[model samples]
Target: MPDSFGRYPNMNISEYLDFFARAYGLRGASRREAVERVPDFTELGDLVNKPIDTLSKGMSQRLCPGRTLIHDPDVLILDEPAAGLDPRARVELRELIRLLASKLQKPGPDQLTHSHRAG
Candidate 1:
C-alpha cells in the first residue's frame, strides 16, 4: 500500500495515476483498466487534471486508496482511513469502503474492525 507521499507534488492527477499504472507494468488494456478503476472508487473526476499539491485534504486522502487499488490487490488494509476527513468526506469515504468490501471476496474473521468513540 502507498503512503501519503504516493502523490507527486508537481504532477496532475491523471499523470500521477498513469505513472503508477505504468510502474506496475500495466499496459494496453491493463493500463487503461488500472487508470479507469481509480475514478470509479474516488470522487476526483473533476480534479483529474489538477496538480496534486493543490488538492484539499479530503481530495488528497482519496489518492492513497486509489493508488493502493491500482494493481487490483486481493486484500486491502486501511488504517485510520477517515482520521482527518470532514463529516461529508467521512461519509463518502465510508460508503466507498463499503462498496469495495462488497466487490472484493469475503474476508476472514478479524480481517476487519471498526472502533468509534464519542467525544
Candidate 2:
C-alpha cells in the first residue's frame, strides 16, 4: 500500500492484498479469512483476480481501505479517500465508510472501546 496503488503488473489484486495482510501479521486462517472479506468490504466483486496494473483509479482506490483493514485496527482514519473519484464514486465511498463504521460493531474482547486516549 503506497500512498497510491502501485502498478504491479505481475500481481493480481488478491496477491497485492495478501502481501499487505502478511506484513500486518495476519497469517494462516486469520489471513485467509481477512482476505476473503476484502472483496465484499471494498465492493471489489469479480475484480479480485484481475492484475493490479489493469485496475482503474476507482478500483485501485478500493485497495487502500482493504489493505489497511486486514488486521482490524482499533481505529481508522481516512485522508480523503474519495479525492480522485467521480461524484458517484465519492457518494458510494462515503456510504462504504459509514457501513464500515456502523455495521462492524460485532461482539469481541472486553477491551474498552477506547483503550488508548487520543492525544
Candidate 3:
C-alpha cells in the first residue's frame, strides 16, 4: 500500500503521508496528529508533497519507518527504523512504538481488570 507516496509518485508531503495512512487503514486524522508530534515534521511534510526523487538520502530514509507504522501491523519488522532520524525523532518514534505495543498488549479494561483482580 504505497498510497500517494508510492502511487502518484509526485504528491506533496501532506498528501503522501495522508494517503499512506489511508492505504494502510489508518485514519487521515490520526496520521496528521502523529506527524505533528515529530520534530521538524513540517519540513518533512513539505518534502512528502514534492517528488520522491527530490528528497535527500536522509529524508527518504526517515520516511520509510513512518510509512511502516501508519498501518499498525501486528508484527512490525523494522530493519532500521532509526537510521536517518535525529536523536529526538528517534526517541519520539521509540515512545510511539512503545505506546502502540502497550495498546496491543492490554485487553479491554472491564474484561482484563475484572478477571485478573477477581482471581
Candidate 4:
C-alpha cells in the first residue's frame, strides 16, 4: 500500500488533489466541485501548494479522506483509519469520518467495528 504521503512526493497539494480528482473521472464542473470539497472538509487550504512530504502526519491523514471522497462513493470502508494518528489527529479523523458517514447516508452506531487479533 502507498504510504500516506502517496506516490507523488514532489507534487504539491493542489496538484495531487487535482490529479486524483481527474483520475477518478471528474472533469469541468464536477472536477471543480470535487476539488472544492477538500477545503470544506479539511484544514488543507493554507497547505494547498505545499508538497505532500512537507505535510505533518495530521495533515497527511486529512488528505486521505478527501481523496477517497472525491468520487462521492456511497460507502467508505477504512481499515485502522486512526492507526498512526496523534491524539488531535485522531479526533479530527473521527469527526471527519462521522461527517462522511452522514453525507454518504450511512448512519449507524457511533463506534466503529474492528476485529482484534490476539498475538
Q: Count of backbone clashes for each model?
A: 0, 0, 5, 0
**Tens digit of lDDT per residue, candidate 4, span 1-119?**
12344547889888888899999898998788768667566768877888888887777777877787677765556656666766676777878866754554234324432323211
Better of 1 and 3 by TM-score: 1
lDDT of 1 by residue, 1-119 (tens): 32245547889988888888898777998788667668666778778889998988888877766775676666666666777677887777667766654543345212342435221
lDDT of 2 by residue, 1-119 (tens): 23365577998888888888898898999888777788788888688899988888887877776776677767665656676677787677656655555444353212222212221
Q: Give the residue spans of candidate 2 off by over 4 A.
A: 1-3, 102-119
- Off by more than 4 A, model 4: 1-5, 101-119
* 56: Cα error in model 4, Å: 0.7
lDDT of 1: 0.69
In candidate 3, list every pair of residues with a backbone clash: 11-49, 12-48, 12-49, 13-48, 13-49
Shift of residue 92 alpha carbon in model 3, Å: 13
Q: Which model, 2 or 3, shows the larger TM-score?
A: 2
Instruction: Tell me each candidate's TM-score.
Output: 0.74, 0.77, 0.48, 0.77
Per-residue error for 67 in candidate 2, Å, reads 1.1
10 residues in a row with least lDDT, candidate 3: 110-119
- Model 4 RMSD in Å is 4.3
